[model samples]
Target: MISDTLIPDTSMTETNTDKDHIKATMKDAILKAAEKVFSDYGFEGASFRAISELCGAKRALILYHFKSKDALWKAVAEDVKTRFLTQFSAYYHEAELKTDLQKSRQLNVAFLKAARDVPEYGRIILHEGLTPNERIKWMSQELKPELVTMPDLQDPFLIEASLSGLIRHMQAGALLYLGSMGPLIAMDTEDADTLLSDASIEQFADYFQAITLARMDQLKQLEEMQKEQVEE
Candidate 1:
């Protein structure tokens, strides 16, 4: 006689799904708490114990989601990056942004909004730049490569200069602006997303955009000059 076949358990399936959801929820909570802890303490300074406590999660549970402190830190960074990208994407493809300046301005505003949405963002950025370390390198190269961009140029010197100017203007301005007139805007305010403010941040943002656009135009002009030279 054949042995009785085991019947499928619907309750067991529901239980598994619930466990998966809880794991996801805990992971999100862990990342949220980790962002603050890492931003306040920096990578070397942040500890898993503090992160677990801040999220009100068990240390072992957090570790079950993220095996190492570095992994946890990266998860927090990824979470912030995801939020930034979500906001950035809104302006990245605006139908009415006819020029690069317009696009950049909108993108910059998105940056400000992202900073406000995630207040820990600016401090984390500042911490990353205080030294030439792996964290910043990972961010620049892997986590969010599109954070920096420039128009086509083949010259090594021009490329370096453009990259430097981008950092000094766009990226640097983002951090500075958020720290300066930034705190004034209520994260929940209706006007927080108006893209310009009375704090003169529009001028600050505009100046940086102009510097970057001028550099881009200069690079494009050189490309034209090279083409003309080839014809001659």
Candidate 2:
């Protein structure tokens, strides 16, 4: 007995679209607020109430988007990962990377920009590093594998010089240098708000890439000599 006019109209579709857009916007805001909170206080010290206040959203809304604190933390981690990979590919081709050393250097450069772009990712890592927990385990599984590295090799004397996992260690340095900028906002720095300005990023990248390449070359030579002695 229903009339044909009873069917859904464009008005209803438009309303639904508007609601979806609002939901996405609210969620993104919550995530942005959470990134700052978690980066500052870390997972243990971070809370929904703080994120809610920071985002100006109700606590209930944050809960609706992320069921628990753990869920929210994991979501943030995933978001950071997506942002990094997205930025890394924004310019060049990954396939174009030739040597493992070159790939590692490029990755460090990429991380420099990625961390500078968001900065929260680097801060989160430093904070998380201070405390080992289930989160780190999850990261090792979900996040660490996203990047490539050289072969499995190490020498105690050449740990900092070796290409094997060089990206990992350099990232630690990068995190300290790049991640600590948020706190440095209070201390007067050049004209810009942070050292992550476009020109500064390029200059720092050039310096890091050059030094890292030299150290890796030295370590490679030492490794070759060790191999020669073993053969003799």
Candidate 3:
């Protein structure tokens, strides 16, 4: 038989643990829903009610978990950055490649895959790029310290902005421009959804890879010519 003091302590501990689990679960749900809503609608357009509804939780619960929409958006951005870095790390460890160029290609492929897997990330990033809000500034500042350690992301800003822009344009261009640019790619307005399809993304990735390789080769040749001129 346990002492009376021991019983209350054990019960309190169990209750606290359960509350923590519930809070974490609710936070995860809120973040998942927030990602979709924030991606579809920019920060100003996103609503706490809509996020709560999507997550099937009360607005009060969302408020309890995240204080405000600004806090929620920041949390979402941090979560995305964490996941992106994790995916990059995993891919870097698994890829056994020969040259820096080859590794760069692999890194791009990994980035594309990660973007496709979490397309919201691209949308959020593009929206931030356009809006230039405090949240965006905060995220950029937070990532700056770690940028030097990421060799694969040598030009992190350019690489990320390029990839995110490509993904966002492919996914949301129709809404922005009434599909005016679709004809250029032989794609009709009705086929906009296909842009996010796995087959289409793979094809696009291949095309991008070829173009990048060609550009790299051209740069190498130009450098060789410059070296020859210097020697002469």
Off by over 4 Å in 3: 1-14, 91-93, 142-202, 221-232
Q: Model 3, residue 87: displacement in angstroms?
A: 3.5
TM-score of each: 0.67, 0.71, 0.64
Q: After superposition, how far is residue 176 of candidate 2 from its true place, in Å?
A: 1.1
**What's model 3's TM-score?**
0.64
Q: What is the per-residue lDDT of model 1 for residues 1-232, given as tens digits with 9 covering 90 to 100?
A: 1111211222455576777776676677777778878888889888878876666677887888899888888888877777767765664554366654565565555565555566566677777778888898887665444543453345454466556666335666667556545546645455555534524555665666677667767778887999999999
Candidate 2: residue 223 lDDT (0-100): 81
Q: Which ten residues in a row have the lowest lDDT in candidate 3?
A: 1-10
Clashes of each: 0, 0, 0
Candidate 3's displacement at residue 174, Å, is 15
Query: On residues 1-232, what C-alpha lDDT tens digit does candidate 2 reach at each position?
Result: 1222322233455576777776777777888888879988999989778887777777888889988888988899889878876776553244366665555456556667777776777777778878778888887677664442332324342345543555567667767876675347535554455466666666766776787667767877888999999999
- Any runs in candidate 2 off by more than 4 Å, and if so which? 1-21, 92-104, 148-163, 181-194, 227-232
Better of 1 and 2 by lDDT: 2
